[model samples]
Target: MKSLIVNADDLGRSAGIDAGIARAHREGIVTSATLMTNGPGAEGGGAVARENPDLGVGVHLVLTYGRPLSDPATVPSLVEPDGGFPVKASAVIGRGRVRTDEVLREYRAQLERARELIGREPTHVDTHHWVQEEPGVFTAFLELARESGLAARPLNDAERERLRAAGVRTPDRYVREFQHPRAIDVAALLALLELIAAAGDGATELMCHPGEPDPELERTSAYAVARPVELATLTDPAVRAKVRELGFQPITYGDL
Candidate 1:
């Protein structure tokens, strides 16, 4: 039997985003969420998570365009002079402009802040824009997660071997299916399900960005109206019937 962990990212991005995430967890089939500590609706999301302890909460580590919780001076090397993390993290990853030690410090601070604000550290850490996959960045993230008692993104064969050597937990599931605004389609939804079915029978996590049908989402947030597909995937009797037919269990991050 296969166990699935479904997660919604960017939970604290906005009220619309927060409400959407909550509603999905309540009625629409979302099981877990990645909290954005510095997001606008962070406090509210944190409150909701506390209220609904069943909803698995994890850290959506941010290194992109958003205000940092820590003071710029406090995390000098992590943010731009304008006091925002880089919106385009890929551009500056190999530019030799950032100090790795300072980056690690800021990450630690962020982890601590998340624990303080949410009242607990995350069970897992996922990068924003997969920026942590960059050189040096992954090591920093791994080290922090190890220190904070959180898990990290899994790696390739050699790296996986190293993780085993270090006694780190490798993710059993991969969220290969994500709801990008541009990639929204019924076919994609079916493909996502197919991928989930194809993943080896073990703990698997499917991450998504499902939100309300709001034009403002496109204007303000990186999320699009993939809620239709996501909602459909959950509420559709056919999909629900399929879950039963396949005899799969939907778990959350905390369930891990």
Candidate 2:
């Protein structure tokens, strides 16, 4: 049997985003979401998660956006001189000085903050901006998942292999093409689903960033304009029907 986890990322970034994610889960096929514990809408996101108990929520670990939950003085290597994280993963990786200890400290803080806000432990862990994929930080990311016993999102085959080797829970495959602006339509989404169906057995995760447009999101995210389109496609009745037609079992990371 084939299973799919449609995980919306960047939750808690803004009220508009939180609204979109909640709508997608309530009215669409979104089975899970990853929360940005330090974001502007974090508290609101928590409220929504509580309201929708079946929506598995997870920590969207951060190192490349916003301020750190840990004190800047404590995780200095993960922050700039201004005490905020850099805007891009490249900046974090290029520094080559991101201490694993610092990654663990900040990630742990984020995880704890998520638990406090959501009123429960998160279902899993994944990175914002795919920051956990950075070689310098990947080890720390794995260590956190191993210690927490939380499932994780592995972006590639190699990461999946490593996660399995470490005895951490993760899906067998990861698919991110649906978020591509050009592919945010129903036809594209259906086609992508078809591909996953053919990839055979095990679980697959489709990373998505569906949200409503707001000034804050527009200002902070380069991919903001495409969000509503993604939201529309995700919640479209046809896409939902297609998912069922293809015999894909929708599940949460916790189910893995």
User: For model 2, which pairs clash?
Assistant: none
lDDT of 1 at 195: 70
Show the lowest summed lDDT stretch of 10 residues, model 2.
Answer: 88-97
List, residue by residue over 49-80, the lDDT tens digit for candidate 2. Answer: 89889999999999988899998999988899
Q: What is the lDDT of every predicted structure here?
A: 0.68, 0.90
- Residue 176 local lDDT, model 1: 47
TM agreement with the true structure for every prediction: 0.86, 0.97
Candidate 2's error at 163, in angstroms?
1.1
**C-alpha lDDT of residue 234 in model 1:** 53
Candidate 2: residue 245 lDDT (0-100) = 96
Which predicted model would earn the best lDDT?
2
lDDT of 2: 0.90
What clash count does candidate 2 reach? Answer: 0
The top-ranked prediction according to TM-score is: 2
